[model samples]
Target chain A: MSRFSFNQITAKPWTLPEMVAGCVAAGVDQVALWREPVAEYGLDRAAALVRDAGLRVTTLCRSGFFQLPGWFDDNRRAIDEAAALRAPVLVLVSGGLPEGSRDLAGAREHVADAIGRLVPDAAAAGVTLAVEPLHPMYAADRCVISTWDQALAIAERHPAEHVGVTVDTYHLWWDDTVLEKIARAGDRIAIYQLADWITPLPAGVLTGRGLPGDGCIDMRAFHDAVDKAGYRGPIEVEVMNADLWERPGRDVLAATMTSFERSFRGR
Target chain B: MSRFSFNQITAKPWTLPEMVAGCVAAGVDQVALWREPVAEYGLDRAAALVRDAGLRVTTLCRSGFFQLPGWFDDNRRAIDEAAALRAPVLVLVSGGLPEGSRDLAGAREHVADAIGRLVPDAAAAGVTLAVEPLHPMYAADRCVISTWDQALAIAERHPAEHVGVTVDTYHLWWDDTVLEKIARAGDRIAIYQLADWITPLPAGVLTGRGLPGDGCIDMRAFHDAVDKAGYRGPIEVEVMNADLWERPGRDVLAATMTSFERSFRGR
Candidate 1:
């Protein structure tokens, strides 16, 4: 059997250390660390303790922007931090369209150029930059990579070991060619993540996500396809919903494990 | 410039005849006719009067099954109706994923098979089949084809000279490959529909579309690509805002024309 990782979207209540412990307790063997938790503790110490914990660090939470200033330097710094942690993938979500620009094509170009400048640092750090295409509802303020073909094309343009894509079903279940793209992406895929899609989206992006089976997503088929696509890497449960973050850490991790198992049953 | 047909999503106050007349008055030369309005006026008479008005019918509003019995036969009847109207395209929106099945892949397979069976009939009548991939949020209860690639695959399955994909911005603006697919589709794209995506989706999908320039879409860049892609078709302004429908019919059409012009900036 293959191992999987789970990332806690928030580090509140029990802190990152406690969440890490909680995930271990829940039978999860790997983790993708986020930025806030690293910020709370100094990076070196956090890396040391995680190494001591006997758990694997699969990927770093993120770094990307279409409209933010100082993004380039910030991204370089993020690569150093990820390198320190020994994580292989750094998630890159291209921030929303620029203010008053109304030019999505321009925004996409900005993201490409930013990646072009930063991929060298990431490559040196031995980290793969994974461009994450967020849901279309988030096109305004979240991310511009909304489909797999676009993500694949971007990754293909870079064509390096350090540049690839993270395919998350929550963000991509609604896309048309997701399965086709997954099969085509083959080994260049960086991360395979899962979250559920729920309606009446809570009036905010951060809180609308549901646990794997709590909502409408058919995660079993997704995992099956990912496995079929030759992606044998960790299937990370990356739930960003504020509701899940607010829940008891142990219960949340336990429930997510159950959902993950259910999603991949005999797939 | 070539004259084109328009599809007014809501035809209130003015009645069907007057709506067609209003579109013609506003320089629209053809139309994508919906079945409900014609049913309200009775079919044979509606057909005769529409034919008499010298307005070309571009597409029929819809025909598919979310979870109904006899879905194939029902949609076959819709194809027959399109034939009667001598419409160039029959818009087939794959019914929503069934209530019990979260199997989106299964739903897509059903859609492809149904279209496969109907392609011969569609070809015999000289009616092209345009598969409309709805917005993802509608996956639960509307059409399941949510990207250009998916629609293209479905079109490939049928391979009828008359089968192609319909690109509606309201349903597809969130996609990353809109320009690429529009260009790649070349002659296979029979229709390109338009609507602006605004936040707080007005509580339901039946309405809540914005006027072209009122939303955040990069309409002009999209325009340049579509034009550069060699699509010299008429820009069909199809808005489904409740607020717009509540206004005077003349007011809605007038505003849509103004927004359409602004959206493309007369390029």
Candidate 2:
């Protein structure tokens, strides 16, 4: 319970203030936030709201979409937002191939180059850029970084504090080599996120993740790997399911907590 | 055109006789057949129908689903069927995690062991078992083997003549390390398939694959790798799309040929 963090996206419809209040009421002292809602509620106000409620911001949801136009300025703004919110990490989902292009190698190299260019800003802003390797299914339209080795290679190019990898079970459980590599990652694992892989994925394949323990992923195996790596940071249960989103915020938070608890049971 | 082998699933509605006649009409001399349809058309008749049409069966579509109850006997039957059809290769899609189980490592080990046990039968039948590593998107419910390395590792254990790997561009394209590894695979490349990766994957994620040049996969790059490995065998264009299945058999084959030609245009 001490290491648990409620990521705001788990309850997509919750207002920032409502989420803050809900967290405080639920005795959850940590949260992970997204940029859209923060901007909607006003950044400073949202920051102040969480701070006044005595909640820690574990991570700023995302920043990197390097394939888009104006990504440089947009990422810098995201860095500033993370700093303002006192979040220690900003997640990077390296964008997929440019429209009508089949240059996956080029797109991946660009992600590394793009991250190198942003390391200085990240270092100065006191936020670690966590490069997340999304599931390979998303490689065509969402994130081109689709393997742990690929993400770690890019992160190894920079200082650990400025750039590290996000270890999300949902995106990585299929790889036979990943668990062993993750066990050796140590500080390169900036943030550990949990989302189970569910079958019959819906159209677009984006919002079909299962809550931890609801799907076939061996949560204990992942815990063993991360624990072996000496990571004792916030464990975020960040799931995105259309059905979960339709429920009330408090109910969703309760369900998330239940799933999180079930994942770590007997540990 | 001499290297082209049209996979029968590309035209799901075509009866075996209709497909055979259509292939002859189009000057197609090769095909890849599935067991269910061959069984439906009566295996001996289907075999003779294609053989009489002067068509070569490149591969018998599939055999391995090791997680099922009667996999051993079923796969044996599949090997015999492949032998009867004179298809030199039999592709294997190692089944996913067993019902309600999360031991992916254990499941993978079972697949390797099962294949090892079947190698003698495969050797006797003069059929090469082609282990296909499906896209990771299918890892949960379709095939636990989800990378070229895993497939190659398993194939390397047995004599290359008895066991080999299936290289499908759609499945292996997301892998950064695969092309170079495949270039060194040589005779382990039993079958080379082409299916492009398209976005907005429909429900189930099974039938959403694109025709060779209809999506983002760089088919020429695959050709370069396999060519470097000294492979001059048949190239099967195996696409599974709901919309494609709705089209007439001749139209689908024509479109597949056009896409296949376009993919190799600049090469």
Q: Which candidate is the best by DockQ?
A: 2
Per-residue C-alpha lDDT of model 1 across residues B1-92, encoded as one tens digit per residue: 14345674644555788877787777766777887787788778778877888778877877766356788788777888888887778887
For residues A9-106, write the lDDT of model 1, one tens digit per residue: 73245577887678666656688888768878889988987887877888888888747988988899888988999998899988987776667767
Docking class of 1: acceptable
Q: Candidate 1, overall lDDT?
A: 0.76
DockQ of each: 0.29, 0.91
lDDT (Cα, tens digit) per residue for candidate 2, span B167-219: 99999999998999999999999999999999889988889999998899999
Compose the digit string of candidate 2's lDDT tens values, residues A104-155. Answer: 9999999999999999999999999999999998898889999999999999
Backbone clashes (count) for model 1: 1
Error in Å for residue B109 of model 1 = 3.1
| TM-score for each predicted model, relative to the true structure | 0.82, 0.99
Which candidate has the highest lDDT of all?
2
What is the fnat of candidate 1? 0.28
Count backbone clashes in candidate 2. 0
For all candidates, the clash counts are: 1, 0
